[model samples]
Target: MARARRTATRWWRWRRSPLRRRIDVAEAWVLLGAWLLAVAGGLLAGLLTTGTVERDLDRQRSERRESPAVVTTDAVAAADQAPVKQIGARSVWATVRWSTPDGSAHTGRTRVPPGTRAGTTITVWTDQRGRLVDEPLSGADAWLRAAIAGVLVAAGAGGAVWVGGRLVRVRLDRQRLRQWGEEWDRIGTQWGRKTG
Candidate 1:
């Protein structure tokens, strides 16, 4: 029991020393601030990203259900028939307006070449449900955009955490070293004269 009390008293004295106390408090604050900032920024980014994804999904669904038919077969429309746009060397899109079998007219854009005109008849493909699908994009621009955004967010958050930890560690190390030096000096003065 006496030994335990001595150990406790020594520990209390070391901790109550001014340098050690400041070091401990600074370390605690750094860790707390780092975690809090990360969590707050992560939540904000997640909410905005989720909303954007939902909106895009809704738009795609609507397009799939109501868009015009894309050309998939050989078509022979008049030279002045359809509004065509060149997407690539071999790909084109034509805006078409036609009446369905039930006498209801709908207009949509179709992917085709520059061969049809404004008033000519052209043969184009229609699915069983008769909805147009836009031509798919060829590159990875969409994925690249998302990846860049993720990297930016990660870099910002990681930098904050690193800086906070470094500051805390440096401050604590200085305080601990100073206190240790003082303790050694006191011990030497007390024992050196007695042993002499």
Candidate 2:
């Protein structure tokens, strides 16, 4: 019962009260609208962003393909840079040659296992044009990216709505304060003369 009374009193601006000014009602409406928009708009934005990201990732998976390539030079001898850990193996940059479906040959530098011997065959990723490219994101990776993007976009949308509401509330408070000051001045003048 006490909690119910507290909740009811919390909405005093919406109740019939002579002390409740027009500004108070306007502020109440702004609060309600802001909350509604923040929830609905943020949800919509997040879903749209997530879907778009997922579709793009799916397209990448469809457009990229793996091809066999032969290392043109010994990785340990040709690689001037230190090996880096990739795909659970220490890799060094080495030139590799591959052929496209049209029997055309292409060579590009790619990461190969350290100490890879010349003429060793390795799998490499390539785009439709036969240019070397990074491996397409797996299903789990794509979902994680989409989820992160959705969360960030949702938070941004909600924050923007909340800031807009705060600005409106601040403006209303200033207007109320100005009106109070004016009323105080007018009433203070009447107090100069005694009623008795």
Candidate 3:
């Protein structure tokens, strides 16, 4: 019963009462609208961002291809070059030459296993234009990226709505306070007892 009374008290602005001022009603409406917008807007933003990211990943997977390339230079151990290991293997940068389907050749630098000798065949990813490119994300990776993007976009959208609502509520509160001060001044002057 106590909890029910507290809930009712909390919603007093919505109840019809002589004490319920216009500002109270306005504040209640603002709170409700902010909650609704935050939920709906967050959901919409999340879905759109997720879909866009997934589609882009899918397009990349479709557009990129792998080609065999020959190592033009021996690869140096990554530990010798950098203090921190970048990946699983001690990979090092080396120049590689590859031929496109159109018989055109291209040379690019890519990471290769440490101590990789020249003339070693290695698979490299490329775009439609035959330029060397990073391999497209795997299925699991794409899903993870999309999920993260969706969550971040959703949180941002919700936060923006919350901030906007908070600003409006603060302005309303200030206005109410100013009006109350003016009313009190008038009433106090009539009583011949002015109080700051």
Candidate 4:
């Protein structure tokens, strides 16, 4: 049937066909290389990107430190601003004081629950200079964050590589088309120009 002939002609580059030209063989090789690059290169790039991301996150987790402190005074209760439907007690700035391991006193203003009274023992994280800082991420939270980052990095790297392969494929296809056109131009004149 016509379908059988179409299928037979489709992969002529992979078979012995008298009509197949040098360009056909070149295109087949180019396509094979493109596929290899898309798969192997993409995977390599994705894995490297993922490892780099996870290591950086681990470094950051190590750099951050944690400490405990106490609220110095009762936090001023925030005024209920009309037209604003607040979900929870709006946090208010309050002075909190804590001492270093050497008993050196330090104080800083930090957000506290509204109406929090002074002397309420509360723990607060601090930095190298004992400045108030957010708590370090827990182990589970860090893993979740790292996994999401890895997935995004992998997708981005793979997409870039896939696009590069497609560009190469398209260039090969254009070259093949131009070569076919040139061959046709040379032979068509033998048929009386336009064949009219």
Give the runs in model 1 whose Cα sits over 4 Å from its true position: 1-22, 42-144
Better of 1 and 3 by TM-score: 3
lDDT against the true structure, each candidate: 0.55, 0.91, 0.91, 0.72
For all predicted structures, in order, the TM-scores are 0.37, 0.86, 0.88, 0.70
In model 2, the runs with Cα more than 4 Å from the true position are: 1-8, 82-89
- Candidate 4 structure quality by residue, lDDT tens digits, 1-196: 3554444466668888788777678777766776677567666766776677667667666766655778877775332332453567567677889876667889998877777888887777766666777777777777777677766666676677667767777887898889889888988877765645
TM-score of 4: 0.70
How does candidate 2 score on lDDT?
0.91
| Backbone Cα, N, C clashes tallied per candidate | 11, 0, 0, 0
lDDT of 4: 0.72
Number of the predicted model whose lDDT against the real structure is largest: 3
* C-alpha RMSD values across all candidates: 11.2, 3.5, 3.9, 4.3
Model 3 lDDT per residue over 1-196, tens place: 3554444476888899998789989999999999999999999999999999999999999999999999998776434566665566757888899999999999999988888988999999999999999999999999999999999999999999999999999999999999899999998888996658
Q: Encode model 2's per-residue lDDT on 1-196: one tens digit a residue.
A: 3554444578987998999999999999999999999888888899999999999999999999999999998997755554544454578889999998778999999988889999999999999999999999999999999999998998899889989999999999999999999999999999897887
Better of 1 and 4 by TM-score: 4
1-196, model 1: which lDDT tens digit per residue? 4564443443442355655566566666666666776667655564565456455545554544333332333334422343653343353445676555566765666655565455545444333355445433223543454445655665566576667677777877888889889989999898878552
Model 2 clash pairs are: none
lDDT, residue 28, model 3 = 95
Q: How far is candidate 3 from the true structure (C-alpha RMSD, Å)?
A: 3.9
Best by TM-score: 3
After TM-score superposition, what is the CA distance of residue 174 in candidate 1 from its true location, in Å?
1.7
The ten-residue window of minimal lDDT in model 2 covers 80-89
Give the runs in model 4 whose Cα sits over 4 Å from its true position: 1-13, 73-86, 89-95, 102-109, 193-196
